[model samples]
Target: MRKLGTVLAALLVIMTAGWAGNAEAAKGIVIDGSTTVGPIAKSFAAYFMKKYKVPVTVSESGSGNGAKSLINGSCDIADMSRSMKPQEIAAAKARRINPVANVVALDCLAMIVHPSNPVRALTEAQIGDIFSGRINNWRQVGGPNFPIVVIQRESNSGTQETFKELVMKGRAVVSGAETQASNGAVKNRVSQTRGAIGFVGLGYLDASVKKIAVNGVIPSAATVKNKTYRLSRDLYMYTNGKPAGVVGTFIDLPKTPDGRRIIQELGFVPKY
Candidate 1:
């Protein structure tokens, strides 16, 4: 009778473990990547989980890591503010992963300064000079004689990449520039530091920091859509191959009216 009881107990444990595995598999849609896209992803995830009754998770690991997560099959979607690099495509192809980019929204990579800074608009050439360390004083740009505090995002950030491509024009950022890990971090640093200039996704812009116009073009829906906002870029969620089933449903959220509302509410442009 003791032997029989032991066998029954072991069987129950096995069944419980199997049940846990099924639960784990049931909670499978995972999203990871860009801090710039974090708010949108989180909002979409909340809507998805609430409406569909499926478990979903979102992580803001930066765009590069998000690509890595998708490449490694750890995530269902990799959110990115910039297009995937050539080498990333090679790596994905080598691993038999076909990455398909779905543009979820649009963002104005806003140039921000401390709210107290008076320098309002900068020409493209001026911005290049400032970020490249050729111009280090706010006085050089018609402002007070304060030393410029140039803040930038870390190398792993898609926002940093887009900034480099658009504003830097192949010039390396000044080595003395301060680097932060995420959009929020950069925003916070710029907000606290006088004469600081940094860039962040438009969603992160608020009263805490002031935005500067680029080349006389103020960032707005009309400007960006008209191609006058040079800092505007498309936001993306990449999937392995084309998404299907629930993955398709989640990826397509940005196209729906509710998704568009969420995007607009978060201060990002919708890609209707």
Candidate 2:
């Protein structure tokens, strides 16, 4: 009788421990990052919650802030439009976090202007000059004589970093350039202002604004996937170490058929 009682107590203890562990693992997932990657993350979150019954929250505070959130342990996934910078990796290592990137999609920074603007293409050098204030009039670029309104993303934006590296080639943006918070915001401003020019992820393109060719190459899913678009970059989701449990499933969603459809629907190119 004594032995039987001891065995049952041990089994109960094991069961209780397992339940506690499950409860901890069920605490849900948090995602933070770029407005460029926001639509994909939100759509994936919705699908995950419906299919797996796992609660997930997503926030688009820009890529720099996404790295900060992951390093600070505030988010499980960091959606970034660019690779983690060296400093961000060092910061994560300092916090005992191993940052791992999963490429989820491909995107290009599409130069956009008002639909009424007839200037349809720009060489990379010309764009650099325009944004840097060297070429500030529409007439100089084969359009009506209107003062060009140059728009840029905030300094903390990954999109801004990419634009500076890819298009600006170390040139500083004009001191008078306007700054917007997100891809959607830039698209909105460009759509409303005839003389305005801005850049946004390919996903943000719509009839509200017109996309211009960069160096004679127009941005399209095929163009981005085939590497014909020079401005193409990979979109990423960063996690601490290898993701396991629900986090693993969520991060790998891009490899699934439904995820590809969702990416296409949102105007982004699926990487897997």
Candidate 3:
């Protein structure tokens, strides 16, 4: 009886090991980077997990960090609000990671201020001056007589890079400007601070704050798609190579009807 029991115990152990190995083989994909893309990524992750029974993890550590993760092979997908720069591409090449961009949606970088602000619109030059610290007072731009508070995204943010390129026009943002890490943080700071001015993706806009038109063009889905909004940019998902398997399906989500609905529901311009 002892010999029979020992053999049965060994067989059970082998069967359990096989099950464990199968479970390990079912590991899920990981996505990280860009708080601006966090909402969309999370929504897609949730839907994919439910529909496919495949686990997916998403994180928002800003765009620069996302690129770093992809180059380092730590993430399966890197969501970026702005395109990768030349230096970034070079770095990836050195690491043997071929970063392929998958354009997912369109985003308009909306300039936001407290609701009480009366300024209707600002020219590109005026917007540039305000961020660069040249126009330090709200009264300088025909608003109330108060000092302007500039809120900017942190240095590692993709939104900050885009804002500097498009709105600053090669000018530097003021050193004294307040830097927030995420779009939600910037929106909250501007909504609560009457004299504050900040920029966020169009999807982040809400009733808590008011958006200002740039060069007479208000940021909307139509304006962004038409390229009439100066602050518009394409959102991207970067894979190490041409995406395959689960990664390919996730990146291709925006082209489907359900994915298009998800993009539009989140206030972004859907491609399909």
Per-residue accuracy of model 1 over 1-272 as CA lDDT, tens digit each: 99999999999999999999778855668889999998999999899889997788889999999999999989999999899999999999999999999999999889999999999999889999999999999999999999998999999999999999988989999999999999999999999999899999988989999999999988876777788888999999999999998999999999899999999999999998
Candidate 2 lDDT by residue in tens digits, 112-210: 999999999988889999999999999998989999999999987989999999998888999999999989889989999989999999999999998
**Alpha carbon lDDT of residue 155, candidate 2?**
80
* Model 2: ten consecutive residues of lowest lDDT: 21-30
Alpha-carbon shift of residue 118 in model 3 (angstroms): 0.8
Clashes of each: 0, 0, 1
Best by TM-score: 1
lDDT of 3 at 244: 94
| lDDT tens digits, residue span 1-272, model 3 | 99999999999999999989667644777899999988999999998889877788898999999999999998999999989989999999999999999998999899999999999798889989999999999999999999999999999899999999888878889998999989999999999999999999989989999999999999899999999998899899999999999888889999999999999999999966
* Worst 10 contiguous positions by lDDT, candidate 1: 21-30
Which residue pairs in model 2 clash with each other? none
Which residue pairs does candidate 3 place in steric collision?
34-62
Each prediction's TM-score versus the true structure: 0.92, 0.90, 0.90
Flag the better candidate by lDDT, 1 or 2: 2
RMSD of 3: 5.1
lDDT of each: 0.92, 0.94, 0.92
